[model samples]
Target: MRLIKRLLPAFSMAVASAAYPVEWSGNLAVEVRTFPSTAQWPEQKDNGLSLSFQPELRHRWNDGDQAFTFIPFVRVDSMDEERTHADIRELKYLHVADGWEVRAGIDKVFWGVTESQHLVDIVNQTDLIENIDGEDKLGQPMVRVTRVLEDGAIDLFLLPWFRERTFPGAEGRLRTPLVVDTDQARYESDAEQKHLDYALRWNQTIGAVDAALSWFDGTARDPELLPGTKGSESILIPYYPQLRQAGLEFQYTGEAWLWKLEAVHRDTEQEDYRAAVGGFEYTFVGIHDTPLDLGVLSEYHYDSRRLAANSPLQDDLFIGTRLTFNDTQSSEVLAGGIFDLDHAGKSFRVEASRRIGQSYKLSLEGQLFSDIASHDPLAAFAADDFIRIELTRYF
Candidate 1:
């Protein structure tokens, strides 16, 4: 079984490349991050650099009824060894029929409706070393079947393997006071990483509203950080508990206005809680007769656990603005702030990007933390404000 599992990926790639003409795309990026504040930990650095590459290859046959896709990613970081890693972002085979489709292999899936937080996206484990917003995810090994309906779709997934979430090492910034010992992870399930997880989702569109209901039975992607000792040094041990979650997503699109909501109820052996994020975005197009659009967004996040919640978003509010320049270069910018209602902690962020030329792009991002409560999760980052720049070349 182990031998076959090891060779399956290679064998699938060989077959795909031989049977069809491969289509190639993706990008290579160089990133630099700068911190203005002094390092809180002696092992941390004030500046960092990294290079990342992701190439996508696809093969399709039978007039698009059958296909194969492969996406491999690698990153080399100068500051943190844990951040320097490689992953298969996607490697999947897909087949489509009259009313249904089937896919198998490693893939990434997203399910959420709110902009501030995604409470319902649970299929893929988070790649925290790549980013803090949970926008990046590791590919998951799954076999999924989807039934297409006239106005809706139903998807069923069987996940055979589990991917642990990545955490920053001792040298990485925005880390906990104690470094996470990823090597000593503990799981509630006796089967551990081999535990079989499954999920089901149904989505439908009615008028201007789109809705989805989903349920997942599996190991929780967000592990509990427990304090432990590692050879006379303090460390945080990751503990994965079994979880059953029910999720709800809703979005209503109107003329220049979008309303979104995402909610989840999660049950575990130690704790059970309900969490939700709801928000709206209103856009003003052609403010002064130019091809510019401005969108105002506001969202509220709530967790039943409140102060006891493991998440930092409990009882918080997010307000942001998105500006899009409808030009050839596709310039865009987003600025936002999340305010903790209970603790008086706030974090502000700004992100902007534009195409430099036909094959290159430039992006800038910044974050600021202020007035963080001592008990707030973000207190550790109070002195870790930084700016990031990225240049990418697309091939």
Candidate 2:
């Protein structure tokens, strides 16, 4: 797979090698997180902290009417036992013309309307509560081609794949009926896996409003079995089966107000699970002469799945607002709740963030789980309370 991925960029470049002037730019970002013991979740009694830093670099050259660009990035997490350990998050080369473009590399792809949804987030940091052993993997390698029409664009990609293999931990043993596997499993071959992604987007202006529509299909693998699960032989777990998604967004700029709305749909198939998600987000901005700007955002998400005879539907709603001061400092508040429409379980979350300076920001997030619903499985491991704090700096 490595050889194939490397050959693709060379081949594409060879097809159109026009000399171009090169330009370079890059940015660095660091994030630190710390958690304190809270009585809300007894299982999370230990205090922990982690730090991560990522640097990005890019070069672009324009020759005549064509352009070539390359971007490569690396990330290091201080929590890693090997202080210098790193992961290649992005390494892509691109060729562009008036209406055609091609790219190849390990890159990040995004396909959703919400910042926190599983369907739309790419280049993500694993949730602190979800990291099995705090292992961070590299981005997927792929080749993509895009065509820019007069008012719209279409793209297709070929992806290289990898899988996660995990051991059964205590939590897995008590919840899942599957037997435990102690030996670590290996990928059949980094060279033979087949993965692909395709996307299309269209944008147009209607009167005073701008609108966009997008579609996506991509592949992803599941994380290793949950800690403490009883699973011995590692089997392929498809996080999403030929995932399909579509999004529509509209924006209206007004003299004293701005309005935006976005909607998305995602469908997935994995093992014995078939799920679909529909989500929407709306934002309202009140423009004033004062230095402060006031805005509100509301979103709704629904996840429907066929797990077992006794499973319940998963649905959630999120409402939030933002207050910006002096154009440089801001505060945001968000509330989200998940409930089983057919059963009796529910979960709620409250999160807040504040920007300290042009380069620094801080955030606190917390979640609560209660009311046992259906026995659909995944919920068994849900904790009563989960909390985390984050500080980030951009350079």
Residue 297 lDDT in candidate 2? 53
lDDT of 2: 0.49
- Give the alpha carbon lDDT tens digit for every residue of 49-108 in model 1: 999999999889998999999999999999899999999999999999999999999999
RMSD of each: 4.8, 8.7
**TM-scores, each model vs. reference:** 0.95, 0.62
Pick the TM-score winner: 1
Pairs in clash, predicted candidate 2: 168-229, 169-228, 169-229, 170-228, 172-228, 172-229, 180-232, 181-231, 181-232
lDDT (C-alpha, whole model) for all candidates: 0.95, 0.49
Tens digits of per-residue lDDT for model 2, 1-395? 99999999988776544343244444444444333323222222233345555555544555433333344444444432222234566777778877888877766565433433443333223322223212333455777777786655666656655423222232221123332232433222333245445566666766667666776655434333333422554333312234566666666766644455555555555333333333334444445556555555544444444333222334544455555554446776666665555556666667678888676778776766667544644354344255667777756
Q: Total clashing residue pairs per candidate?
A: 0, 9
